[model samples]
Target chain A: MDNQYIEEAYKEGFTVRFAVKKRLFSEQSEFQKVEIVESTHHGKMLFNDGAAMVSERDEAIYHEMIAHVPLLVHPNPQKVLVIGGGDGGTAREVLRHDSVKECVMVEIDSSVVEGSREFIPKTSCVFTNPRLRLTIGDGVAFMAETKEKFDVILVDSTDPVGPAQPLFGPEFYGNVFRCLNDNGIVVAQGETPFYEPEAQRSLVGIMGKFFAVVRPYNFTNMTYPGGLWSFIFASKGLDPIRDVRVGAEQKLGDFFYYNPDIHRASFSLPTFMRKNLSGLLRDK
Target chain B: MDNQYIEEAYKEGFTVRFAVKKRLFSEQSEFQKVEIVESTHHGKMLFNDGAAMVSERDEAIYHEMIAHVPLLVHPNPQKVLVIGGGDGGTAREVLRHDSVKECVMVEIDSSVVEGSREFIPKTSCVFTNPRLRLTIGDGVAFMAETKEKFDVILVDSTDPVGPAQPLFGPEFYGNVFRCLNDNGIVVAQGETPFYEPEAQRSLVGIMGKFFAVVRPYNFTNMTYPGGLWSFIFASKGLDPIRDVRVGAEQKLGDFFYYNPDIHRASFSLPTFMRKNLSGLLRDK
Candidate 1:
């Protein structure tokens, strides 16, 4: 099985291949195709719509980065909300913060959660956390109707395609903006700026219109398209740079990637990205 | 050949595959096997002994990072020396600086220079520069005998395997140290820390013993395994952080992946890396 590899057609002409050890499970849910495969390079992996989402090997980097960046920014984030993180990894990282009283994860697809729990249990095990409330519904609709406001809202959607396409729209960001308190924060998984430039540009463009402090940061995620992946943080009031500090909880334990230095370092954009950003922000 | 993809075994169990368009050239040189292939995703690619070295698309990132970081650190970099960068991308980038009076490239393999000049003409055309002197010989031996000191020595070597293994030793580093001027700087391609932790640790360890300031930084090279790739900078006097500036040449044109903020940001290691570095530096 060393030669037998699963290739993901990420962009039109680009693809990333991973050697598969075995196919644990594969099924098409009502929303999208879900699969769990153990790979020779990465550990147990979960795929939604044939796109690699989370792998047990480097899941900590993505999960810790998404949850901690904003959580650390807000001085006191009592309540948090996560949209489209069906794999439960985001919820797990969110639970690490002692300041968070409640974490509600609204995932549109129920099968992704079931498959993740069954196949990629390492990241999906957060379902048992007492503070977590898993809500199976459209994240946009949930955010629009919710009366409660959050200190941080992490939009851990898949790439802007199929069920996740709506998550990147103006309406969705508007809903997220309305669902946040003053000095609240929202961090969304911006697509690869290199491979998926349209997705990255459009998301950052839209987010810039609403938030006072709109910043994007990047980290290497091997499971993703270009390996170089981006994430956007939009704050209503708090600035990620000035407000964020090295929290005690973050210093102690399970996080293998995110730290105080990385939290700051991730904001530095390379020249190509700087060019894209300089042009994009100037237009906005 | 849309479906035809060439895969390189980067490590014992890990591999990275690139969509191939055509096989440009293949030959067994005196030092190593050299191949030039056009890829569907990455324009043109050069490989040595079945290991991917550079691709046209993201080669600027690697080339700019290795050359500009040190070139910019030196107040006035007039004399520059590059070892093992037969692809000529390093020379091309180094020549971008206006202050460079002489750019000497010491390549161990004459065939690599020939192949790169013939096949990768876009990056290799720097050979035509009046100030450039291409020396085809063993870089280790050349550095040991050469009395000409340089402001910066950019080592753009392949993985420390086969012919390139000797370049990573202490004696070779000592030669590089002696070949550099009083305020000299040397930046080496220090393998992938995530995948080749032993290589990264040893290289950093060896350099620390010789240089007054030693720093290891990493960036995403999609062509490389682990996505995370490391580079070590050893300076006799100047600190890359305190001394390096975004120069006029870097800001003018052609550079796609390096900038002032990135220069500072590159030194900020991630937590996983910080842990490895912290403990390793302490032991030394």
Candidate 2:
């Protein structure tokens, strides 16, 4: 069979093309279209509704960043909640922290979990860890009804479209705020600033109304549309920078991206982003 | 007419496509292939040998970073040299500092200058400035023969292939060291760490032999191959982070990306880059 090229058009004019060695599996799940392909550039990759989600080569940067930053901020995060991370990458990083006694992952689509578990084992291997409890259900519905609180809640959903649309609005953030401890922190993927500044502004503005400290940090994701991606960090009372323990990153054995220096430096936004998100970011 | 899309494959497996509204100009220059196209996503873009050089939409991030960081690190950069920035974007930024008495820009290709001057005048408009003296010649030859010393040198060459290959070797750096003052600094485009770790390690390793302080910092360039790009900072006796004047960025009236926080944050490389470049970086 001839090698195929998969092109993802980010917008009208820009696109990224990945050469695939083979298409392992493809299915139209209830939530979205889940795909698994062996790519020459990115290793085995998983896609949700035609959007690249995780790949073996570059998943560490996105996973390590989302999990380590907030885990380092909270003094002792014994309990954690992860929403919509069916690929198990987020759960893998969350379980890395020894302080966490239990990690509850509620992913809406069972196909993503099943596909990732078999296709992308590097990230999905953590699904079998003893500390993890997997639940196949809607993340938004679970957030609204859960009486339990978490020290850190990671909202690792797809783009703010289709099933992930509610995750970016005020209702979801209000429920997230209600279910967090006084010193809790929630970090969510806030889209790319280059192409989605308006989405970022609205996300930050909604979170700022609920959390005392809301700041967006940056990381480079090659598979994403604009190369640069942001994660919104919202807290009840603790600051992501000041509250972080100095030597906490050493505890995470080997990280591809996140470190103590990077944890702090990631908060520095470019002047353009800072200007566009002026009133939304609550640094204090 | 149907919209034409131009695709540049960074490697065998990865590529980026840009939608072109019209082909403004195309020619085979003496040094390389010079092309200008009006892009829907990037505004007017200049491509050299099929590689995207600078886009009007995102030129500020790359140009401001290459110019302002070293300028702020040195106490007073009176005389500066820029090599291979034929688009004049680098000189536009270099002239922003009022302390710059003379800015010498040496570009090997006149076609690039002429085409950019006509099609992308937003950046090429700086060629009319009195402080900048444009020279058309081989940058390696100019560095080897220049009798005058500069307070700062900016090597804004293309990729390590083609006619720009000589700019990345040890000989060019040796001459750059010889032409710098006691506290002079040199910042060179050191390729992206994601796709060119070997090039980065080699560049940092070579500069380590010449300067007391040699470090590589990163910035995100979406037009580039891997979304992430790096610039190597080398100095005779100055530390880029500590020697930078506090609040000096205020003097530069308005900037799109360069700031004091960004200047400090850019040096914090990821864990993988740090491990790969372990002994090559001389922080002291």
Candidate 3:
């Protein structure tokens, strides 16, 4: 523990610096560089390939949003699959639903999971859930070959670089389309709309080729670039708004970010995003 | 300016650094230190007392949300008052409506007005508009003495420190309540809920005593502390949603952030915000 700082350059000239009290863990994992540090403001922070992956203070904002939005929308999410969520935060939210009988998580890097278990137990505590079947392998390959059907698939991958690059490709989405049931839904971490619109539009364009419903929703992430981050929701035919279960959101206990009102409001895109993401948004 | 960087520490341990291309203008105004610099990512940025005020790239997100939300709610806003917006961005949006016959802006520091006009024309261009009447004076004093009534009043002051401290007090809001018409609406810059919840709760508590409807809405700001900022909307009787004029948003030429969908969506609070701001929020 010492006076150390970690800076993330969001763009060419904009950077966010965090005062780290100590470096808890640092490793060159098989997939990417995984580092965990205890920071002053955000407690435990995780970085994958130098990109901020999770923080203790604001982890629920991303994890609850990614898990609850899709799980609440699905009629009966009895079975769920999470890809690339080595942190176990997504599975923790997924198993909160009593209707979920089984959950499977596939992570490419074991170091991320091990690091989370030791340092970020707030999210990694889901490892002991009896319903979860943890798999250590590549998610893209798993999606391409699995014959099992899932009611919901949460693609909690990193940014579209390094090992996560294949997860954003057309072939991976095509495989994801085949693994889901008829009323199944898939939600992925779309890039920040303000900073990475071109990549977001491109990813939505690829998703549009296979799914009948594609929509992007946004939330405020404190550590991310632009403070605004988006998630791409692709479904076979379910509309997130019209098909929302009446009392579904109430069953989930309490949350930091995700709420019934936020579920609908997150889809209300700004004018600039609507113009920039035109033709790519299937709901529009 | 060659290899310069300006860092803003939001909290004790978190900071956002911007690479400065050149210093456009820097002056010690009577109230605070005003500086305008050409930044690499945000184009030209204005900083008031080392805090990010406005940037050329994302100025519309803050300006549009403040002005349009109140203006569109009032049925006919012929007279508008802007307090502490020396940058002219709020007045520019206020005068965009043809119904506004006059707009009076009172800013304490004259140097902020002059510096903005010379360096940041995109927001300061409203100085030449014939409908705007610029005055150099203290807004807190003007609100207590002026007998003139306005349909909409925008309190676009800086953070609750230095000269802007009185603007967040109960006496000022009491004066503002008396100086407004029956159905008048007043919207002021509420601090970020995530980082400054105590201030946000206290301000909302003050406004609740003066107005019948007091609600706080949030938006995403790139350079702000938590990337999420809030505004307090207080009205005598008019509701922002129920009393919204039909087809009024279409009258707006074009916007980067404000829209009919966004107007409604911005008021939805996340779970944590709702819990922390329970008794203070009038709508909840």
Interface Cα RMSD per model, in Å? 2.0, 1.1, 0.9
lDDT of 1 by residue, B1-284 (tens): 13376667655355567878888888898878898889887888898988888888888888888988888889989999999899999999999888999999999888788888888987899999998998988888898899999999988898888888888899989988888889999999988767777788888888887888888877786677667787899888788877766465445476688877887888878777776776444211
**lDDT (tens digit, per residue) of candidate 1 on A101-130:** 999999988888988888887888999999
Q: Per-residue error at B75 for model 3, in Å?
A: 0.1
Descending-DockQ candidate ranking: 3, 2, 1
User: Model 1's CAPRI class?
Assistant: medium
Candidate 2 residue lDDT tens string, A54-167: 878889999999999999989999999999989999999999999999999999999999998888899899988999999999988999999999999999989999999999
Q: How well is candidate 2 docked (DockQ)?
A: 0.79
| Chain A vs native chain A, TM-score per candidate | 0.94, 0.98, 0.97
Q: Which candidate, 1 or 2, would have the higher lDDT against the true structure?
A: 2
Candidate 3: global Cα-lDDT? 0.91
Candidate 1, chain A: TM-score?
0.94
In model 1, the Cα lDDT at residue A85 comes to: 89
**B-chain TM-score, candidate 2:** 0.98
**What DockQ does each listed candidate score?**
0.61, 0.79, 0.85
lDDT of 2 by residue, B1-284 (tens): 23487767778588788899889988998778898999987899898988889989899999999999999989999999999999999999999999999999999999999999999998999999999999999999999998999999999999999989999999999999999999999999989888889988998999998999998888887788778889999999889898899988897899888788999999999998999899899976
